[model samples]
Target chain A: MSVLLTPDQTAFLQGTLSMNVGAVGRDGWPCVCRAQGLVVARDRRSLTVLLSASRGRAVLESLDAGSAITLVASRPATHATLQLKAARAARVGVSAAHHAASARCVAAFGAELETLGYAAGLSATLAGVLPTDDLVALRFAPDIVFDQTPGPDAGRVLAHT
Target chain B: MNISLESLRPCLDGAIPAVVATASPDGTPNVAYASQVHYVDSEHVALSFQFFSKTRENVLAHPYAQVQVIEPKSFRHFRLKVHYLRTETSGPLFEYMKAQLAGIAARSGMAKVFALRGADVYRVLDIENVDPRLLPAPAPPDALLKLRRTFAHLGACDDLTRLADRALAALAHGFGIRHALLALLDETGGALYTLASLGYSASGVGAEVALGEGLIGVAAREAIPVRINYHTGDYTYHAALYVADPASPRIPLPVLADPHSQIAVPLTHGEYLVGVLYAESEENAFFSHADEDALVVYGRHLAALIVQLAALPDDAEPALAAPAPAPSGAPLAVRYFAHDHSVFVDNDYLIKGVAGSILWTLLNEHAASGRRDFCNRELRRDPRLPLPDFGDNLETRLILLARRLAERCPQIALEKTGRGRFRLELARPLQLNAG
Candidate 1:
């Protein structure tokens, strides 16, 4: 059975700083980056990320060339991670996913980082210092998920229900 | 101005009830009166009639049908030469037709007409063509008019990256190009540096072309738009130009492989050619004179944006200063994208997930009504069920979801507006830096 994340778990997975996304290139090399504003599908079975075409296009092209991809997201600071091995399902318009991810991100961190300086920093890093027209939304269907949290109790938490 | 169904009803007032006409296997004309002539969405109309009609039977046999709807009194007509695909009998469309039939019956004092609903079917209408004379006369050039009125709006954009993106968006949206590239001329106007490109790889951006090198360079050097046909052209100078791969099978290199169309519009401010907006398509003669005119207009607007950005003080904030908040209680414009799982505030603050949808619908309703508040009166009411809420745990879950989104995107604010209403607002418009 697939590991189902509760609302709290989902939130933790999203806000956790250590969750990394690994993508495989056509040459079989894996490129790993921090998963920004990763969102779970409404059905709780899929996760999506808004990837700039500049960076994510390579992975998409690789997938189009029939290369399988694995995305591992983890909160290293808390020693909690959700690693999902999946293939690219589709690429949609950035506007479609950005709005959702932005809203969720705002709600998730809006109160804690209300300062203008923080907003500027967030915008600079997350929205990119420059805007490109081909920024796209990548939807991935996870074939397998691996979760690891620290401590003896972490094992139970990572255990499939 | 708000366009309502009432206003649209007048357009169809004189339109005749369409008749589906098809040829039988024996070449006999089979015709059936179609009552399914109603607005589908805001722009298109849907027509539904009985599937078992002679015309439907003939259409199934032939896959081709001509539908005619004439002005009731004038006999002036509209015809649609359509190829029938399939029939959808259930779902939202069926319910929509049911409600429409009910309204029609009520208005015509024939409520019994809806009683035979199942037998009275609906046919999907696809408009193939419209009589040219039926269309209204060409409107005056509103581009220049809008530019005059909204020059300040363009002037307000302070970021070069955004200006570039917007310029390309205008080109793609207006000209229907699969991809676009904006390469700014270096300070000396000698070489072109790819500042940003749509539908091309990252490696393509920042690439350079010397003055008088390729199409873009020629356009920049001459300060004129360069139109090229790649298939038969002497590509000795255009071999290294970057072309978007996903758009077509043709490669950007080896420009002489197959016949392709390309247009390069130099971005100019008065006399200075600041950049080149290049667009291409694999098909022959992809662009027209009218398209070139639009691109020139767009190029002018983009030049204006660049000049304004260049004129801004170096120390000034990168985004437009917020015009004082619209009173504390002013409603905000919001758009909800449930299928895509996102919400936009004033079409700017794009937030992800169901929380965005909730906030979007609430704010949109309140804004449209000039009201200050709304509640969860219709939660998860969409039949498509794109959102998943765990019943009473909605608030808590949403709060968590909001926090997750905030971690990456901190500019958006979701706050309680009143007792039951929530407002999602952008702290500032997104700023895109060119460097």
Candidate 2:
């Protein structure tokens, strides 16, 4: 079943997945690279990450091998981090929910998003104008989600999701 | 010069005013004016006059006497007292009295008449009881207030080295010492390191002394101030480290050369002796009782500062928790980087080395917390020979090291990353294992 996330959940997923995605590396070793972009599925049950193939291929290979991995996603200013543990499934295409999540990230980070080439590259990739081979999507189905949020309201939002 | 009555009457046929005071059996004090008294020594006063004086009778009965000689114009007072032993009408005192009377008569233009009469002198013998109230009231609160200010100043200081220097300077200035040095106790409290010094050549500092070695050591061991006359034969345990010129003929070289006064005050935090403050002067009586009191006050404040400084935790080191175990069924890769020579174990150990071992030893010895940056800097500047590489061959070496570590510690998951970094992920949170 595809789960539709509310705006708060969408924001939460973007933050958590962003942190966790950076932790993933080839052969369980973190490599020197940056987070490209985070795209959440319309149902919010899945998140699509666009990263450098060169930098991310090793981590994807580790995930494909069924190695248990932990991704730490967090919002920098707020001490909110989500540790999502799961093996990677097959590659999937960007969905409407993914584009909406991307737009929200762009709006939240604004000019800062350009520094990571996330907003520009993600937009190009989704328009069908950019080549898809340049990007590889790992559909993360969270097995265990650990949410560290500051207050009761944030905890409820994470718990409900 | 207001001479006592006994001296005045014998010298000039002039009577001098004197006041005799005595404490009665019931503790009540009695004072009487006497027209006859004389100076026996700088410390003693004698009276020779008619026995009808109440003070004379009091002194005769009680045998305890206090006499004051007052220079009415200058307001200067000389006080003395003696307990009576016996009375004598003739002796050198009598001859001295005769000379004084003739002089008095000559000064008064009655020399012929006074010379014909001769001089009468009565000597009081034995001095059993004499009370001299030379010390003023002890202003304990005033001393305490100065001590409090000193402590507050020291407490506001954040730097240990600077604080120690300031304290030594204050001590030296307050006590008027020609030279002062403060030596901090080493880890075992068996030795001392000179932390600060004043009024000495550069060669006179950075000296170390063992326990029971010098005045400093004695003060530390006894936990009290040690006052010595360096020139006296009594103090032979002077530390060579403190001597500016050992071959010089004088031992303490006499304060500046006076060799008569020296003091070593132990800086203590509670029962622990942190260091000693040594002060010396060239004068025989440089350190009066007042100076000793001042030093004690200063020493107490210094001790408090040393204690407070010792209590402050070192924040330079990074807090390194033990490596956590990797998740279940995860492949472990470990790598050793030779450039930095740091061991990067899988997600677990960030950095470890012989430098770390040395730092650990120092921290433990000093009872200090290990700081990451400080440890790193120490390693970078380490004067000792470099440690051997973890393995001859990086790849095979790491694999063996990992298997060995795994066998010894079953809980920790050690994995080798293809990159220089290794991951040691925890199967469970680190806090659970803490129990």
Candidate 3:
């Protein structure tokens, strides 16, 4: 069954909170890590997560074989969570726009963590090491969208119209 | 070079999240993001088994797995090669993981959904530091130094009173903790009664918290350390809420309105649940992994010390000191509520439960017979004080009563005259109101 992302969720994906990508290997094992950047496609039908080359090796290798990808985006201040699963996945070179979006996301994420009571200088310090020089954008069209907001309806799907 | 699990503690503490990857026998892999990987010991770690759909199946088929962990401050990553061990359905570890998960779920607003079915224990086959160490991070000067000082202070105490004093002092002076408490288990009441505290306007001594009710109670029940980094509404145990709740209608125990960070560690002596040690701070994530680590070490020492002190025989009292004449003043009105065993002095709430009952009995004896000297042996034999478990807590109760009377009802005080004997000192005339 296909699902769609709500408008609010689309904005959330494009927001500055923390983002993570989980992908299964060819042998059905999973690899996940913090993403350097995330951008919800303008169409709101797909997402572009800039995977860090140094840390996301397994995720990058699992891009083929149509290995499933689950993107968990969360707001640090509110603990608001959204998990997106996609079977149709591919990795492409990071575009100029992807870099801009990724930059915006990291900047906002650090701010969010700060606002949520983490000490100052933490966000900036984290951002310095997170920005990857070379990146690959793992873009996937969403086949399943779950509420995952840490409650009863967390895993409930957003059914497609 | 092979690294032991002890060296990887900074990674296993779970301040940061972890990722688990498992491959199927058919060469297909699955990945699941986990909130934390519980470090059971040096060679073992347990993962929460909560409605495991894919990871379970994949792990069953392919037992070998890899976990990636990140250091919060350093951004350093470590990988662990682990082999799946048997799942624990029940035991101290399961209960510990279950309680910890409840707190995590509550903070994340998933309290009801994130239930623990079993704890999946894994044997660490190897630990690899993926990211090269950058200027090896030194242990915080305060944590290491403070833990040593705290342990030393606790080790030197020969009695429970001095032990408690040094423990609280270490928390405040050595560890720089503003708020902390030590409550011992009341097996008879199935509760933990507060005996000592620091950084509260009121010591809240003698306050009763039922087992499995609040953070401290749950920690004692599970016999595990419950650490909450960020405060949430779900776990906040308000005094007023408990008064209305049927489970614990005795008295509402006091805790900080909204403690940003709280950690409660259970004190155990062998198989017995001795008590719980709780500390909180207004600052978010106030307690670091180091703080928890230090406190854990201190708690173990404190528990052993407590057991040793408990095993000692009662002390001999000094010759009874002559009771001084009452000061010239108005009679102090001591109102006793039989319904809840709450005592009020001059209409001010003093204490309730066993402590309250103990106070009323003390005052009654002083008013009738003019007897000021009391001993632990007699209080244990008192028929009206609702003694439980063969007076196992007589001296502690006296200590609690003495402390409460000292803090709240200054008109009346109980000064220790001997090892297990105390002389009731009245500053003014006493008018006892019994319900």
Candidate 4:
């Protein structure tokens, strides 16, 4: 059965969490890249993950309709982690709204990194959040959510609302 | 341009957590932060599998993975396409990773949560620099040249004591190793005793480490080199395992209260455990894989020299010494315990075990006849002393006893008159007591 993200989980994923998006290739091997931000829909059933076009070109090219996708979001300081798996995902066209939302999220992440001993501009530098930066968005409705908080209880399935 | 994983070893230090991406057999992808990405070789790498997470399950189903590692200093990212090879639960690699995880876990305040279950080996199929921008990496020191020079200096030593001194000196000067120790293995007792040490406030000579106690002991027991780049309280041998017994005076093992990096290399000759060479630094990640490799080679040279020097027969005749005049000052009380053969001078601990027995025998003969000269052959044949077999390390025990006396109580000193011969020089008159 498909599962939807809980209110708390959706809010946490949209916050300053470090995100990594992965996609499987035709050869069954997987490719991954660091994502800048995640924007969850009002229904909390679908989300848009953003990545730098230049750094994530290989993963972007592999993303198609019905392509298997996984996005892991983790809080660096606490190592509180969660994995969202979508059996079908696709690359979506980028819009100015998506870019602006990603920019604000990246700024928040940079502030979060600052508290964790990273430099001020580190998040922007890592995410390539400049005005000239090219961003790609992959949208998927996760069907499974797993708690990956790094302990014996990790990999346990999270209940959906 | 082609890039080798060997050149990017600094990225594997766990300074920046690496991300591993794998897929399930049904084409579902899994991505997570890898606890550790250890460099096994140019073609192989190992990741710490602490828990059976989705990543582990996916990798078991689909063996291919993409690992993204970043050099912390430059923040340059490199992607490695790897294939799962196998997993090792126990062995040299497992122990190495386990020690590494302990340190990492302690640093992150997750010491109990993070335990290494196995070392999952992976074959790196390809490597890619995510960004084309490059930073100039500094050239590493020539370890081969340093090892060659150290071996050259070791080849010139004449005796076991001199050989130990020269090797420690070489480790300091040639390899820039500030703190180092060389210990000789006591096979019958299943322990290793410190023969020589440098860069410690105390020489810690005559100190003992059981065959399976700490880093040095573990290396000796496994006959492999073990290294850790961070301080780990898990292997606190002296503080946790050592118990002081009044029956036997314990020689405290010399240790840095908080060592950030340490490496112990076992000195072995085929199947025989010869000794262990150990060094530590206050800086994290100070010892590299190249340093470990050089030390392993250097340990071999040390083992061969020890065997060679021990087997050489004494070619010089025993020296004849005149009886010394008794001192006029107050006598110093020398007490001997026959239980563990511990010897104390002026009610202070000096040494114990075989060395202690040798000292008691020498002092007894001196009190009875004022004899100052001795030879290795006589000590081995003496029924009163419990000396090991002829091929065993009688010379090393004398060296340990000689060093302990030189450090603790300089009133009595042993000087080598020639090979296999030595003279006991006493500056004070002593009253011998056996309790």
Candidate 3, residues B91-169, lDDT tens digits: the string is 7787667656654565555565677789999998777665553433455456778887776655677677887777877
Candidate 4 lDDT over B1-435, as tens digits, reads 289998788788766678999987778788988878999988999999999887899888888999999875455678999999999999888877887777666555567788899999999999988767555335568789888877766668879989878889888777888888887787464788889998988888888877767777778777888877666666542222432342356877777877877888989877777999999888777777778889999998889889999988875676777667766577889999998889999989999888999999999998899788999888889988876665468898899999999999898999888899998888888999999
RMSD of 2: 47.0
Ranked candidates, highest TM-score first: 4, 3, 2, 1
Please list the C-alpha lDDT of all candidates, in the order they appear: 0.46, 0.43, 0.71, 0.81
For residues A1-161, what per-residue lDDT tens digits would candidate 4 score against the true structure? 45677899987887778788888877677999888768898888899888888888777766763458888998877888899987777778888888888788777766786676554566656554323277888888888888988788888889542
Docking verdict class for candidate 3: acceptable
Instruction: Kindly list the interface RMSD, in angstroms, of each predicted candidate in the order they appear.
Output: 31.4, 47.8, 3.7, 2.1
* Displacement of the residue A103 alpha carbon in candidate 4, Å: 5.9
Report the TM-score of candidate 2, chain A only: 0.55
lDDT of 2 by residue, B304-324 (tens): 865665445344534444443
Top model number, lDDT = 4
For DockQ, candidate 2 versus 3, the one ahead is 3
Clash count in backbone of candidate 1: 32
Question: Candidate 1 vs candidate 4: which has greater lDDT?
Answer: 4
What DockQ values do the models have? 0.01, 0.00, 0.28, 0.59
Q: What would the TM-scores of all predictions be?
A: 0.27, 0.31, 0.80, 0.89
- Across the candidates, what are chain A's individual TM-scores? 0.63, 0.55, 0.90, 0.87
The regions of model 1 sitting more than 4 angstroms off are: A1-161, B1-156, B237-259, B316-435
Worst 10 residues of 2 chain A by lDDT: A24-33
| Model 2 alpha-carbon drift over 4 Å, by segment | A1-161, B1-155, B229-237, B241-258, B316-435
**Candidate 4's error at A71, in angstroms?**
1.2
